[model samples]
Target: MSSAAIFVNIFALSCLVISLIKDRAKTKQSLLVAVKSFFRILPIVLIIIIFIGLLLGFVPLDLISKTMGEQAGFGGVILIASVGAILHIPALIAFPLAASLLKGGASVAAVAAFITTLTMIGTVTLPLEIKELGKKMALLRNGVSFIFAIIIALIMGMML
Candidate 1:
């Protein structure tokens, strides 16, 4: 593992120990809460892992490269962004998938756009957002997010 990861682990362990020393009951309660949250999200995590494995295993490299590679240009970035916006995958899962795509010859712009739109814009949750936040606000937020995601992708492409 990287030194940064090791340092984080050490820091977390130290914090846990300090918390336990300061308040045993509260620490126990916090651990219980953490475990419950992990279990609640476990199924989704497994599903994402399975889907990613299947995607990488079955999809042809040539096809992936053809659609998302350097040659695919701005249109490809927009296409990936739209796909990302529509898909309901969690951000944690999206990173590995994006990395895999990059390794498979996808352009940085396409990957960046995918990640940006996936996290920022939520087409799948639009109905709920509209219901809770009102139609105008929801639409405006999503529309602006979509435009900005494209701009960010273009800038990333230029810089990197």
Candidate 2:
């Protein structure tokens, strides 16, 4: 779990225990609600993570490195961003992958674009986002993120 999550859990449990001492009935009801929500969301999140892992497994690292190497230029950046759009990679996996790509001679622009787009935008989870946030908001956010990735790639190319 993330530090934020751990901290929240500790804080919440402390509050719950305090509440239990003050009002057992209300605390029991609140705990039931919290437990129910956790159960409902945990399985979905786990399944998505597993699916992303499987998707990542299908794409060979050598292939990505070769296709997005410095010689590929802006084409490499676009390609990497496209791949990021298709895969819902977690930050933990994405960072190490980026480092590996860098070591394999992938362009800095391509890797930067891939990492930014992978984290900021999520076409793989777009449907769920649209459902939760409305289609327009999801599209706008994703479109902005995609465009920004390209702009960042260009700047990185110029700088590095």
Q: Which pairs of residues collide in model 2?
A: none
**Which structure among the candidates has the greatest lDDT?**
1
Please provide TM-scores, in order, for all candidate models, with all chains considered together.
Answer: 0.85, 0.59
Q: Please name the candidate that would achieve the greatest TM-score relative to the true structure.
A: 1
* Total clashing pairs in model 2: 0
User: All candidates' lDDT scores?
Assistant: 0.91, 0.81
Instruction: Give the per-residue lDDT digits (tens) of candidate 2, residues 1-160.
Output: 9898899999988998899999999998998998998787676667665755664566675665678877787788898887886777565567757766776668889988988888889877889999999999999999999999889987997799
**Per-residue C-alpha lDDT of model 1 across residues 1-160, encoded as one tens digit per residue:** 9898899999989999999999999999999998998898889888877877887788898788889988999889989999999998878778878988997789999999999999999988999999999999999999999999999999998999
RMSD of each candidate relative to the true structure:
2.2, 6.4
Cα error, residue 98 of model 2, in Å, equals 0.5
